[model samples]
Target: MYAAFRDTVSMREVFDSCSGVTDVVSWNTVLGGYVKCGDIGNARMMFEEMPQRNGVSWSAMVGAYAGSGELDVAREMLDEMPAVGRNIVTWNSMITGFARHGLLPLARKMFDEMPVRNLVSWNTMIRGYAVNGEMDGARKLFDVMPEKDVISWTCMISGYAQAGRYTETLELFREMQSESSARPNEVTMVSVLSACAHLTALEEGRWAHTYIDKHKMVLDNDFNLGAALVDMYAKCGKTDMAVKIFHSLDQKNVSAWNALITGLAVNGDVQDCIDVFEQMKRSGEKPNDVTFVGVLTACAHSGLVDEGRRCFQSMSSSNCGVQPEAKHYGCMVDMLGRAGLLEEAEELIRSMPMAPDVMILGALLGACRMHKRFDVAERVQSEIIGLNTRQAGCHVLISDVYAAAGKWGEALDARRVLQKCTIRKLPGSSSSMR
Candidate 1:
């Protein structure tokens, strides 16, 4: 009972109070409790005090050492174990430890040297590769597995999705559906939906939603899946479906709220996006950086300068405490520039704590072209050139700004610079002397 609760102090008290000798099971249980609690010192002492140790005791100690990142000590313990007593569980522990610590080569070496293998062993290696962004290595091992499970499929699919290979993610999911007998779980659906969202594959995403319904995969229980579905629909220009799913969730987390809010912004339902953000705050979900991005995006879309300014200012330690990141500032600059508040936008850029990126500068330049503010455009051009950017679009915009203001020489100069930026000599070629 003491070991089950993992209350080592109480267990020790009961152990001392025992009038009779404790069995090996009792000792192993206490040892496991200490390991579970991460009290390695006490666990080691308990191991030494054990009159006789079993395979469980040794395996527990090895796992504890490996888990705590004491790989050398774990290896020593494993080697000390009698060959007959060593088990696949012990080998897996070592591999898992090495993989967790980013020691992939060592993990692969251990996996290859193992006298026997199991599903867990293969999964561990595959997961290690996937987690490290080595999807090619993971796929190689996955293709040859004697058997595949949901975990194996999820690991590969999610890996591709995370690595920004959305096309491959969907392709693999299709293969999983047709070739594998294993059913897709909530995790698999989440990745599938995420890829669908990125690719705007509304039909495919709808199928995933239908599959979820057919399987009775409760969205209320998994907010991540709920959020993914919302995102997929929103990106596909189906704000109505996204709204329905958002409202269907009995419990909405920050992620789910973010998806709905951002979706509304993308779909040009500016007012609805702002309303949902207000609703989100009233529901006591502290607005995060992403929430503000959606809000600011909505404001920018509809030229809500005052509202955008208010929302931008609220992203402070005193309010939502989300410091305005570069993107947030860029959105504000874009909004102000579009509204013909060129000076204010330039002021905001100057006030930024970090160096303004090319995108932020480009927004100001584009606005200068729109408003015929050649003076401001010239200054922005200097800043862009100062940054040594290779973006031809910014340079073209500057040339257009000059042309709009009837400064032909300056316009030609800008075009020449753009031409120079586009030209590059081949590695083995040069201009002929004559």
Candidate 2:
């Protein structure tokens, strides 16, 4: 945009670079850019500063905050909207934001209270339920829709895909294909392909790939369908096919790298995950938290304690400018514990500026369980159970730890606590959450 403006005769024309693109195009781009940059603060400032706010501007801000995991901010913004009438897009934004944060009840409530709705609104709610693993709810809603469109069908299929309901997902895809009125677009194909990968249905994935190729989807295509195909192949365990598809792409983005890195990690190719991480760094593509998760998971699975720590320490570089959050800390504890450095793990947890949350302590406690350290296990049991008695597997482990030490009374007490409590484990459960 800047280059085009520079080449033009009218030097008076300003670019978004000049902070003059305050129209929907400019505001949307800037707001969306803030989201993509993970600077929700700046995004919110830009939003508040906009002189005229339209549905697009409002929707952009809502989506921006939601995308950056600021659902509360989104809800507050939604509440401030004019109540004379609600626009479907703005309502959908709130619904989607709630869904993104796993507040399915809130999303459903919004859906129920809406005066009017469109296909996107319905799709947003359905996808929300689907992503939250409430497939029954998704199906229930799906069964009652008075009308169905490609988006509605795609949302249903996506829910199944996310929930690992491949058979149902594929069946729905077949149904969609048979229906002449609904044509599956690239987004629909992405979901279907994702389902195939989840089920490891390589044969079925091949059929989908063939269809995409037959239709010349690679030429002037939707956003990175080829890369999605590569990810689908990698996940389906068709390594050669995935490589071929990946090599065929002339351009690749960080998302493409993420898919491959995470797929390799899931497949237990830890060395490959590390190699890909290095390759991505060499390619000038900075690693995000998702990238760190994949690499850290690989390290945990492969017992690369020192390597994991080294990689984690390197994250302090100003180039990436990424902070090591609770997830990163938890991964480190897991790695240290896996390598039998129980004392070191314990020390790291204790030294953290943010009080060690359940995740870090849980990792350490799990290691204690593996190593039969009754003392550490006993302390960890108290902390973890205090955080959330309803946490699955922890109560059992702590009870077993007591039982191992011949403390039958304590074991029984642990069992009773689990049986009696309906305690809710706090959400996010991170040191920073405090």
By summed lDDT, the worst window of 10 consecutive residues in model 1 runs over: 425-434
Q: Estimate each model's TM-score.
A: 0.86, 0.65
The model with the greatest lDDT is 1
lDDT of 2 by residue, 291-318 (tens): 8888888898899887898788888787
Candidate 1: global Cα-lDDT? 0.90
